[model samples]
Target chain A: MDKSLQKTEQEEIESKRKVYREAKEQTRKNARRLRFDESNPQPKKDSVDSPRKRFYRQRAHSNPFSDHRLDYPKSPESMDWSKYYPQYHDKESNNMLQDVEIADIGCGYGGLLINLSKEFPKTLCLGMEIRVQVTQYVEDRIIALREQNKSKDINYQNIAVIRGNAMKFLPNFFKKSQLSKMFFCFPDPHFKQRKHKARIITNTLLSEYAYALKVGGIIYTITDVEDLHNWMVEHLTEHPLFERLDKQWEDQDKCVEIMYNSTEEGQKVERNKGDKFIACFRRLPDPEI
Target chain B: MKHPYQNIVSTSTHLFVSVQNHLQAFDVEGNLVGSWKDTIGHEDLLKKQQLEKIEKLNQEPEIKRAENNKKVKIPKIPTPGPGAPTIYNYIRDLELTHDNKYLIGITDSDKSIIIFEINLNEDNCLKLIKRQTFPKRPCSISIADDNSTVIIGDKFGDVYKIPIIGENVPEKDLKPILGHVSLLTDVLITEHNGKQYILSSDRDEHIKVSNYPITYVVKHWLFGHDEFISSMVQFDFDRELLVTGGGDDYIYLWNWYGNKLLSKYPLRDLIEPLLDESHLPPERFLHEDSPKEISVVKMITMDKFVVVLFQKVNGLLVLEIKDETLHLVELFPLDYPLIDISAGGDKIFGLSEDKIITQFTFNGKLTIDDKEFKGMIENNPCEVQSKEEFYPLYTMNTLRKRSEH
Candidate 1:
């Protein structure tokens, strides 16, 4: 072989090896980004890219009865909303400029929060998820969106996610009549009769929800399980503090439409050709004794 | 093989002590006046309830599938085997009506509230009038101020109201007026400004105040605790003040009607020195280095002093209320840990381990006067297999919610 041809072959091999090494390094970086470091949760400088859903996958069900270690404020006055909404913090008063008015319980993958962030740009929205990894995924997703839109309008700073057991302590995080809207999109069915108490919607838990919600506030619920839908309807209707909203009301409501299509669970149900049942209830004023 | 008194209650003429399934009444002179033991009828009732539960459990899957109109495979209900026979049925939560005309006690064997007519003059001082079984074990009960109604709080977090003199309502037809998702620890009926209120506390550290009969109207939640609440007491000197204690290291003083925390009296500093190896977390925790925890077992208000008992600790902590704050007055230690405490008039009776009763009175100082009732309850016949059999006496610690997945 000629010396020039041998030199060209050597150069080609060197370039191919360099490409392999760079690809390996990129894979390593992605893996690190996916791993959640609970102690050091700050996002990396280059985390502007969207997180891969497959990397943040977790079990869909969590037992509400179990003693899950959760961090929550003792009362609404003690909750430091500034940590969640840093942009809304007022330095002189040492508090957030506005309270979170909308809450998405069991916000799986946070699709609804992302959509609501743009729809209600002025309102602060919070997503509470019980599962740890899923909550971290949503936190990362929001951080990346905010970083991507750093200089643009609607920077995704209005939406945040927190790990919590919403069933145990709703009043601890929100003051009496603090919330304007609450969404329960595609909650766990808990089909067994013995496990019915563990369901999100019960006559007892409704009182807590009513306490946290304003008199005119709305509770939006949607599920693919017909039984669960009726269960929610029956319980909400039975509660004196809540009244079922008419279908016509649901048809005109903005949150109802967003809830039906924006959640990851809702989208999955849609793809499977499942029937989706929706119910809306308005919190009623307390009766004078 | 002596069994400690599981519960104690007092009236002007008689002192009632329950040892396992046997209840004995003693006069002021330490003479046994009347005695009654739980009959075989209670066992029969328990068996019937167990069978009914199994039947219900077996039918549930079919009912759920039909209601859903979906083909879903539900897990099969396991049939429990006849494993062993144990004498765990004991009398708990003994109380007397305001008029002292009736005695109420909860029997665990059948999960029934037994109401007996009290007549100290008759040869049979106690006469069983009604035995009402509940869907779940009744953990705590309170009588209405008018004495017309009895409020029962069960282990499943349901509070049911039944007329004190009415017929037994079938369990299936009974409805809970109010409930919590967590296990109920205590329930109390109190009145302020002529309006009655139902105060209920649960293992989730929630103290809910609701309007009686209109239990749907939740007035507010007293929300300062971070651990399970085991005991609660209302001050007689000031009806507005409420004292509560539990798994936390502190007891709280609150104006429950106003939903305000007046003070938190720290107990960890006093309890930490009394902890032993038995105070370690359950064996399932895997973590060997976790610190010991305290569980407040019982509390009673006596005049201006609030007396508290902790699980597995051989002592009573007396705190005095002054200037809207609780100050530790005395750490009254005993030879054995007290399993239960009750107050009548100005006297406090603490039933300790191995069938011991220690009487106490406060006249600017904590004084013990066990001479009258010491030998009276020692001869009462209730059996215990070993020291380990007293584990139930310290079960308040089990209410502490573990962080395991």
Candidate 2:
């Protein structure tokens, strides 16, 4: 088993090395072309073409304007993590009950993740996104934040990003009573009238959230769409193992301040008084009956 | 043979002595062409704007009496519009689209800008057509002439040429144009003597001017600060001269082509009064007790004057350098820090620290026709500037490097 694990690690290393080489070479060519343009002004064309060739690799790889997408050519199958766990700095540091260790679901593009991490530096933060492109995006975001942390002592080891479906892989990864806080700031509303149930925050999903969170663990929901907000409230409020916090709790809740100021979504909502209704629910102990 | 601003001038300003024939062609939008620029009394700008609005609403003129304090909600206004820019904050850095058109903004929810074309169009129209998204956070963005390629500069020194093709697809290799190790604050495709150049500035005290293979380091060891270089701008009239504002509380004017040294404009005067009687941060401030945190310098204009809107004071200061002298002019003050400023034609637009735009003229008469803006006391009668940190416990060093680079 050890040997196989080593072999798998080596394969991962090789794959990343190849990707780095491609990125480096691409960087060099791009630098050259950019420099060329600086010296000689060139008229822009209609397309921001992607130069995808591995040094003249071909027309097949080229994206005329660079935004072309297609399915992965099989065996380029993306990696999946299940029954996976990371080495935490310490064990006594389980942040579930005492502090908020949040998992921002569907952290698209990443603005929300960045803001939340900064606002609640003490809160253990994790971002989950299913889109492979945006997952890599969160990776870069973590890297940049880590870079900016150099001059200040703001430690964000508490923060991380993982690629997986929160719905599919929650049980395989985190055991029950793990996360203290869960945020569904903004999800793909799937406003398609028929696909209304396809939305991320659902009653079944609330159960999943209940499973992952410890007793007293809180779930925070916010959305600009009134329909989605009502839907979220309806689902979570009806869940048996949950109870609502009071206005004082809402006001004194650090998470409330975090919610109010942290995300670009927060800023937009605040600006328009845009019905960005927020609701917080706490997980209750399972019924003895 | 020698000029004081030669040190920071990337392209010197062709200085303007007085106002010229102002074009009355357009006022921001082409349709709102009321009174473009017929050198009327200073009040004409806002007054004419109001009269035009009255005409648009077809409201009967009010009797000759006192103006009402009750204001109408001008939807196309100083209020939130459909084009109200959605700024993305990735903790430390900021990214705004070329315009709040399609996908107005994108950030990693942290400090990274991923490339996404929003229809971030700041237009009056509600329809949006966001064509594509890139996985890079470009700190600065500008479009090429054909509008096909948008040049995006990231804080990590990656410059990308994003193709604005109509469709978003997967097969394309999106990453292009990469260099530098620091965040780029602003970028401009400059034209000088029929030559083209890309001038980029960062938190570093240098403004890089390049034409690809040939790159000119306009201001290398700008000796002013020990902190980040926040921004740089050319005096509109000067093509070879430019000014840079940094955390060091000093604005620099450099000579672009000649790479000559220039004088420094210390910003101590503007905030010195505010910093009076202050509790000190670990860093140094002009006044003994003043908190020495790195105050950010926002926008600089070419007329040898920089308008700095800092956190402590959200007001505008006119930093002018004329005849080899530097002066700070206080145009007006805002309730909060000024984040961004944009000027087109003679009208000026400023965004406050609160993310709202206060649209008005930087230069206006004491009264708008009848309502007089009684000149504020340089030293207000009853109020005393506080000596405490405006934002207690909030460290400006949060913008500085923290650790894991």
Candidate 3:
């Protein structure tokens, strides 16, 4: 029995190495294709379209303009989360409650999600992004990470990335009290007075966030702009369902450490020696009327 | 440059400036007269009380043991963000009544449309006459000819006609008069050939003219703009002529009565030189070599010229319409992108998003003393002197006109 177990372990290690090699080979081919495309540009119609144009076109066609069905799912249960995180698809256990419990809004390039996945391996996490190519790159990165770490039993099956406007489809993706943690890192500070309503954190949007978050859920926000940082702090501090967590608690939190250093934007800011302002708020229980 | 007001509406002598949470009226000479701030509504008071209660409960550890009920509706308390005071509660649309006795505005905070009676005799005292909440947030509002009725167009593409004289009506009592099935950008009530019609534009590049009061009957659908139509205006002299500016890099002229496209003014070259790449997002798609599109925010038309404000372009395009030809007048470059502009009695005011109000003459002359405007108290009353100098950052070349093939 001992000899048989040892043989099986050796086979598993060999298969894992093969998967890693195959993933590396696929990445190398993707790089080569990108180079070829650069040398001789493709004639695809979408190749000429910039990301801003694509973003505007997508917004004009979604939700209030066209059918909300395209951007929003009626219920979170209807969405197949397993397709995004295939390694987590357990065939032996027929459980329906297993789902993404953490979300990163506007997770550009998804550096935080990748880091947090390793810290909380059992918990499912999702990165929601609006840009198409950025989301695709993140998806590919996760696939590669999963293959490379298959042998170590610390694979990136807990994380996934999806391309969608988080502002419009947040409730569609998350059920009530479905999320334990939500993160907003390095959001675009609209700066313009008229465009403040387009901000991710508002009194109206906070209600939606509170509805999706568990009673004890935590909201983490970090930004480089002092004005935007103060704006987020004031809004979150005044929200009835949220209470600002103690600074000491945030300093000790492992997630906060990763949030400060893990994201692509965070690293860039670090290199520039830019000051990062972080604020965390815990969702209070519903008020007893 | 600072834009003290986000939206400015003008009569002949009175300029109703939308400041923070209230509407402040200024004379043609730029002296502060009356101010109007809407009182907290009943629902808003309840929301505030609930917030205070929650704060108390969260502070005391022993009282937190009480079981909380999830079914109770908790109202959202809008917190004033850290920036300019009252940043969250901005006037989405403000208009002066036909008689100039009342100033009406739509505030996005409580989704309330408030009417303030401006009594110039009593030191410009403004009394809140009525405040009504809408089912959806209103983007643009137009007071009717009689001033008793107002036509409001919402972001959801629904237009509703509510009586300004009536008692407060609940949300269920109010219904949309007409809808476009797409996000409505601007709405106008105009009389053409002795008949009233509702001229509306949307994000889907559609401009529809329908008979007012009986708006279900569509009269004309002008389809030329390929993107979001941000602003539209009817010529003061000839209502037949309509001008529209949008996400597309052109200003369109239309003869609405005949439903014909008269001329298209290409704005790409005029605005290309003013485009600052630093203002754009740092996303991968916004990298160098990508074509950028400039959008028009608002268009203000005077008798001889029309001033068009482009989004993110800190400059105003002064265009002259002579006979059937549209000629470029001059480009006055500003330090900041203005939010709203109002013109009356040979004076024009440009309101910036940074709370700087830059006043100009009808001939594109910067009127404010630069030192005082940048250093003094922003909200205090100050005399605005028009400098005889007309500084042109760039000379106006001939307009590059385009036509549909």
Per DockQ, the best of the predicted structures is: 1
Docking quality category of candidate 3 according to DockQ thresholds: incorrect
Model 1 steric clash pairs: none
For TM-score, the strongest prediction is 1
Query: What is the per-residue lDDT of model 2 for residues B1-405, given as tens digits with 9 covering 90 to 100?
Result: 100100000111101000111111112222211111222332333364566576654463454222653345352423347988543222222222334322222233322222333221223222223323334455666554345455667644545555555554442355333233345666655556766556665544335555421221111222333456666666657667666665666666676555443767776665655542221444432456444443654564634555565545546666676754456555365556554454433344443323223444444211111211121111111222452312122223434432221
In the range A95-189, model 2's lDDT, one tens digit per residue, is 23232267887665556666666676666677776655455545544544543453565644356667655543443345457688887776656
| Runs with alpha carbons beyond 4 Å of true place in candidate 3 | A1-289, B1-3, B39-87, B278-288, B353-355, B363-405
Superior by DockQ: candidate 1 or candidate 3: 1
True contacts kept of 2: 0.00
Model 3 chain A poorest 10 in a row by lDDT: A53-62
TM-score, predicted candidate 2 vs. hidden true structure: 0.36
User: Order the candidates by DockQ, highest first — what do you get?
Assistant: 1, 3, 2
Tell me which of candidates 2 and 3 scores higher on DockQ: 3
Would you estimate the TM-scores of all the predictions? 0.87, 0.36, 0.51
Least well predicted 10-residue stretch by lDDT in candidate 2 chain B: B2-11
Ranking by TM-score: 1, 3, 2
Error of 3 at A95 (Å): 58
Q: Provide per-model DockQ scores.
A: 0.42, 0.02, 0.03
Measured on C-alpha atoms, candidate 3 has an lDDT of 0.70
Query: How do the candidates rank by lDDT, highest first?
Result: 1, 3, 2
State each model's C-alpha RMSD to the native.
8.2, 26.8, 18.6
